[model samples]
Target: MAVVAVSAGIMPDGYGSDRCWLNYDRGFIWSFLGPVCCILGINAVLFIIILILLRTALSQMQHGPAHDKLIKMVVFKTLVQSVIVGLPWILGFFTRSSQALDVVFHVLNSQQGTFIFLLHCVLNEEVRKQFRSCCRRMTNKE
Candidate 1:
């Protein structure tokens, strides 16, 4: 991606057009390469941050059955959350603004918001404890 950006004459000022792969006119190259490089750079940074977070979480879970379980749960939840949160953003990248906004609003105002709220409630220790205690008498379990 970086190669494409650089070769397409996308670099900032002081980076001459002579370095580009194709010898297109300066104005044409600038107009075509600008947005592509900008979007690619933003996506690269976001992915790097996510990778760092995952690596840190993995390093912290060194051993123990509970830690292993927690790691698995975290990985699963992260994957699900990524899909839920990123789907709209991904779609928006390829869509016109009006259509993207319509899709975003539909998802945000529907079951997606409710699912996020429920996940938040379930993950809270106090709520989980109360839920467990309430179910214990009914099932002889916790």
Candidate 2:
């Protein structure tokens, strides 16, 4: 799917035609929107699947203490992260390309990595312990 989208991007409608190709300059909609839409579509489908699985898990754990709260927290976090990561790109579709927008877009774009790392490691008890243990082991070795 990615290969197809990339191929489509590289060989857009105007490619190889001197009159319209313009030296392979990919237009905004083709280069950005196409891939962005494809990725967002894929993510949406995956999110639906995740919700289904989470629903099943919740149903199974209905009697367990605090499981419901944990499930809600997970869902809320997922939704918030999705909005944070996706909102800028979606808004970019409407806003014109400007320095301000570029800065905003890049900032939002770069935050995903940091956010994911913090979410998965810093806020996660198991990962935080493992990270600290690795740090201790390295220091001890040194």
The number of the candidate with the highest lDDT is: 2
Cα-based lDDT for every prediction: 0.61, 0.71
Model 2 weakest 10-residue run by lDDT: 15-24
Candidate 2: tens digits of C-alpha lDDT, residues 1-142: 6755676676655434553222235462455466778888888898889888888887887565578668877887787778777877876665455768866777877787887777766777778899899999999998
lDDT of 1 at 62: 69
Q: Give lDDT tens digits, candidate 1, residues 102-141.
A: 6674675466777666666776566899888888877985
| TM-score list, all predictions | 0.45, 0.62
Q: Clash totals for all models, in order?
A: 0, 0
Q: Which one is best on TM-score?
A: 2
Overall local distance difference test of candidate 2: 0.71
Off by over 4 Å in 2: 1-28, 95-98, 129-142
Instruction: Give candidate 1 misplaced runs (Cα > 4 Å).
Output: 1-44, 93-105, 108-110, 123-126, 134-142
The root-mean-square deviation over C-alpha atoms between each candidate and the true structure, in angstroms, is 11.6, 5.4
